[model samples]
Target chain A: MVKPIIEVFDLTAAYGDFVLLDKVTFDVRRGEVFVILGGSGCGKSTLMKHLIGLLRPAAGRILIDGGDINNASGQERADLLKKFGVMYQSGALFGSLTLEENVMLPMEEFTKLPPEARRLVARMKLSLVGLERFSGHFPSEVSGGMQKRAAIARAMALDPEVLFLDEPSAGLDPVTSAGLDELILRLNKNLGVTFVIVSHELASIYAVADRVIMLDQTKKGILAEGAPGELRDHDSNPFVHAFFHRETAEVAG
Target chain B: MDFNQKTGCLKLGARLDAGEVSALWSAVGGRVRHVDASPLETCDGAGLALIWYVQKGGATVTGLRPEIAALLRPFDHLPVDPADAPPRDNSLFGQLGRAASQIWNDTRDQVAFIGEFTVTALRCAVSPGQVRWGDMWVIAQRAGVDALIVAGMVSLLTGMIMAFQSSVPLKQFGVDIFVVNLVALAILRELGPIMTAVVLAGRSGSAFAAEIGTMKVNEEIDALVTMGIEPMRFLVVPRVLAGFLVTPVLTVYANFLGVAGGFFVMMALGFPFMALWNQLVSAVGVTDVMTGTIKSFVFGILVAGVGCLRGLQTGTGASAVGVSTTRAVVSGIFLIVLVDAVFAAIFYTIQW
Candidate 1:
């Protein structure tokens, strides 16, 4: 069997007396979009931070691309982070950078490539996200959709094998969210990069995800994990059913 | 409603909203729309209401899908454009004139992160590079200009006063020669540095805090950290270094003007200018002027340090800017006095 790109074994994360995530064992394979669906306080974003080495787990290990980050040093963790593109939920674009400069940031920091090469890479990445014309625009000058795209381009600038997206479609209109979903699919198939997306946007999830990991609050752990259609058909839990079909079910009744 | 069937799980992203238009926008989505919408509305005491016209551009822009952003690129409907925007906000010009200094602070933070090792090493005490050349430039350019403007104006008036006040004493004692020393020594050592820093603490120092504090409240700081930047090196060091280097020069200038004032007074009272100049030279010591220049340098550091530190302490939101600016000025002046007292105590003890 192929080794999973990411592995979380018996993970129990805590903050003071509060156990944020308990015994969360999961594996995300290479080159597939996997969505983690949960409510606001269900510790999903916290979980995302842990996966990216921004937070530590109280118990258990997180191995990314088969290297253990739970036991890694700070330098090692940063090096590991360089391998993954993260488009933060809030579109964490630097205010000092023009949209073009924001995309070029990673290339500038981690690579020895000169200014011309870096600009070319930034332009290409921007073009990938349909933001090629906005290289001169600042985050404030562009629309919200464009900002998210530029952020995505920045994340992809390093050409990572794994991408961590925290709520990629959080604030977008349904149409824009659909466009992002399409981009993720294209990136996964074309670039062969693994995606670990934390989102509760139902339409985007149903439109894109190959598999789902539902964090059940009452249980404080994984309630279900499987292909979207399979979970919808077989999971007896009403919570599982509501989430898998949230797109068709949320707005109407 | 069973736990599963409730299906409210999707609202997580929107829950961070604590604002007036929570219904329309949430989290990352909220501010962009509000910032854009501001250009389209006007305030006539309705407490920041959105006019119907506010939605007109949004509608047209949204309908055109992709073309309208290209078409409306060159115009601004809002006054001052909120004084925040990249390229504009990131430049030296923006740092001086921008209303939203907090935004600039965050942007500078990104620079620090990129140059973290250089910044971290330079700021370390091994070399005592707490002072930096970039900071020297900013202080010389921005803070220096402010100090000169205020000190020059205030000194002119102060000189006028010295001339007027010393006339009576000089006429009676015919010791008008002493008046120049009194003005020069008093202004140089004690009054000059202290007064100049106090005024700057109110003017430039507070302005620094307000700008940085506003960006803090806006999640601009968060943006910097995620991008691997340090806010301290980019934002704090430059301004702190500036204040440190520039304050002493203004203090010395104030001293010269004070002596000029006394000279004017002595001449008006019929004590010859040459006589006054000679007597003042004889009465004054280099120690007195040196003591004041040292004090001014210390005061300048205090002013800049307090301003930058308080700006960093600002929380997210517009109101935090005002709070941080007040803290910057108050703490700067307070620290200046505290340092002055320490200097006074040490000098007396050493002399004994």
Candidate 2:
């Protein structure tokens, strides 16, 4: 079996006394579309924060690529963060930056490439997300879907080995959402990049996720982790059953 | 449900673009709401936010008066020009027109800034009554403590310098008796408040701008506005009040320290101790110290007002922070100098 590129053990966290995630453990394989499935506020986003070193676990460790990022030095942590691209829920694109510049930000900060080379790299990444046409377009000038794709392009700009996207299709239409799901699958299949996606969009999960991690909100997070098909057929937990049940999506074939 | 299947968004983009914010509340007796340009379409969120921020910040300043907002209608339709200019357009009339339009654009920008400042100030000054007294006390305490500490250190060094400088002069004059008087009067009335105000403008004024500017950037100001509150009542008035209240106390402390600075210089100048003490005591009356303290108070008010105003005018991101801070310090010093001149006029005019 391949070694897990990411690991979390006995993880729990809180904001003051309010518990966010509790005792969550999981491992993600390299270059797979790993889904963290949960409703809003189900601690999935919190887990993402913990994974990225934005928040520290209360009682456990997160080992990313064999190193405990929580315990890493500031520079080391930044270096680790530089290795993964994040598409925040709102995309968090700098307003002052055009779509191309947004894609080039990480490269500019982390790479030694001169100006023209950086633009070339940024343009190439934008095209990978089908956004080459929108390179000079500002975030406000693009559609929601385009912004997310631009964010994805920005995320992939550094050619990161791991991609962490927080709800890539939260506000998109179903068709657009499906398009994004396919994009995720294609990126994983083609680019050999590990993807950790946080979303409760069942269609998206079933369509793209190879392995699903479910957060049981009432029973303290990541309640089940397995193939989505298995979880649908075998899981006895009420929430799990109801979650994957999603009417079996009517094959229609 | 499958809206995309029918028309793929149906050109709602233009509707959303043309949507004014006032259109959002069209239920009762309102006109169309003008929604800001959508975030997904363009991240003009910061620009729209700036409009609100300047309004809240009370941008009631000298430059770019609000009337400039109407002077530049053509600015929104900015024309794009490529590499080479048409060679013959350099007529005097053309130059004058360009200059006039440039000033017009600048004024519009200033008007926008005014709106930004006012919005931020309004956000800061909410609930003025709740902590009004508390804010005053805090400002007073801060000024008094900072003044005393600064004065103590400065006085010790100042006294040493005065002792050294005056020593040579006294030795040269053989009248060394006047050294102590010179030190007391100069330090207490003229040097102390001026020096202290400058220091506070750098230290306290910059800090105020940073703190408020950060709050502005973080959407705290927006939160206040959403809650139907005025920020100026909560943030600005308290700060401005604190400055006015604290400055006088600080001035007194600074004056005392400056005098001690001069005194220390005197002691080292080989002047007779009793003579030095008498000369210093004779030079300083209650009036000189009071006038210095009053000037300090006015300076403090200027510092706080300018700092808070500058802070509230900051844009909703990190980039605007440096600009806010710089403006705060520059404006604070400017106002302090202007007010000082006004005070100088008043003092001399009434010098009966």
Candidate 3:
């Protein structure tokens, strides 16, 4: 069995008086595409933020590569941060920088690579996402899908052990979104990088996810956990079944 | 990682990551002909990049690790070429030509914006019910009422400083009584209106630019246009009207506060309160106050108009709103000073 790259035990997330997630327990194994899927307002984004240490969990622990993310400090914390990369829903590329410069920013900050080597590495990362041709273009100049791809390249700049994507296919069309899924699969297969994707796109989930955990807004916990196909075909939970089958809860109920 | 200089062979280590591979390139150099990856246990993207970098330099890498080979295979066909450099115009004449063109284009845009605003203002004037009175009231409270304290404080300090400075030199010539005339003339004719206008330029002008610029960036303005709404009528007119109405009122209030400040200095200098009041009434007239009021009205239009113009002219990208805001403040102050100079010349020529 592959060792878990991330271990979450009894994680609780809340915003002040309102709790969004409660006693959420899950583990992501090394080199697999693990997805968190739920409908709107289901706390998928909240969980992703907590996993990346952007938000503090109200209760429980999150362990990334054997180190407790909450307890680590100083150099240890910086080292832990370098272990994962995040691509936000908006692509979040700096408007002033070209795509190559955006990819090189992480390397410039974290590595001791010479300028020439850094440029070459940035080009390589862009090439990985098929964005080498648009390296000189700004984020505003590219299509939404291309910007997302450039963002992925920037995320891979430091060769993080895990990559977290928030709603990667939310605004993309079927073709562009499928292309992104293919890119994600290729990167995972070739580099053996773990992917933690937060998405509700059924086609994308079935295409790339090795394992998935479905969260429920009302229950504030995982409703189902299994392969996408298994959950879609045989899950007993009404909410999980409704989600996978694209049926309203009323019909499934 | 170990590299044999004489044998032209590079040996990989158990772990190759970003931190460990930084020095790998320097050690391998260009002389590397073969890479021995049989001993390699783990490699990341950066490590793969290093290997690819060597392979692209014509070195043959031999290894039995299927996993690492899979990582390198995808990028193997990608050509190792440098990115195209951004174009630059380094010559002095090229730079001058660009600057001249930008200035000419900016002047043309400014004139066109003024024409458009004039047409909108006239249309709104014809149908007064079309104006957004609620938005105008809100802008009035924000730009005028909220600004009273700062405007009054600045006016008061200016009056006090003028009185004290003039009194010092006048006392030397036994003409200290003339200090009241000097303070009244300066505050009512110039200081009050100019100070109030400057405050509005910094406060309301920047806010207008930032608000509109953000709307432009978010495509909200485009949405308004698509909905058959003119942005100038829907947005700029209300703010401009509120500015035009409030500036003169603020200027009058600032003028009173400035005179009060001068009264304090005169009282502190042992001059009788009644004597200073009588002197001020005789020296300052309705025209003196009217000149400042008229200047404030024009300054108000310039400041608010420039802000709205900059906002509507906002470019695309993350820094667009920021750039527009900066331009609003700069252009607002510049226009105020230029128009004030014209006002000064007219007043001087007429001996007002």
> For this target, which candidate reaches the highest lDDT against the unseen true structure?
3
Candidate 1 local lDDT, B322-352, one digit each (tens): 7889988988888888998898887678652
- A best-first ranking of the candidates according to their lDDT comes to 3, 1, 2
Q: Which tens-of-lDDT digit does each residue in B148-188 have in candidate 3?
A: 99999999999999988889999999989889899988899
lDDT of 3 by residue, A1-253 (tens): 7679999999999999899999999999999999999989999999999999999999999999988888999999999998999999999999999999999998889888777778888888999999888898889889999999999999989888999999999999999999999999998987778999999999999999999999999999998999999998898888888888899989989
Residue A190, model 1: lDDT of: 55
RMSD of each: 21.8, 17.5, 2.0
lDDT of 2 by residue, A1-253 (tens): 8889898898998888888788877899998899998656788888889898898888899988888887888788777776688899888888778887887787677655455446655665666677766778778678889889888988887667799999988999999999898888877775677999999888888898899988866777777889998999898766677677654313311
Give the Å error, residue B310, model 1. 15
Strongest candidate by DockQ:
3
Show model 3 residue runs off by greater than 4 Å. B3-9, B24-36, B60-66, B85-90
DockQ of 3: 0.58
How well does each candidate superpose onto the true structure, as a TM-score?
Answer: 0.50, 0.68, 0.95
- What shift in Å separates residue B271 of candidate 1 from its native position after superposition? 29
Q: lDDT of all the models against the reference?
A: 0.69, 0.69, 0.91
Runs with alpha carbons beyond 4 Å of true place in candidate 1: A74-78, A245-253, B1-352
* Candidate 2 C-alpha lDDT tens digits along B1-352: 0113232221112221112322321221112122222222321111222223223333221222232233222122322211122244589998999999977975675576557545654655574345557766776666457656765566556655765677676768787666666667666666677777777787778878888899898888889888986676666666777777766766776667666666656655455667767776687677777777778877877788778767877875466788889988888778777877787787778761
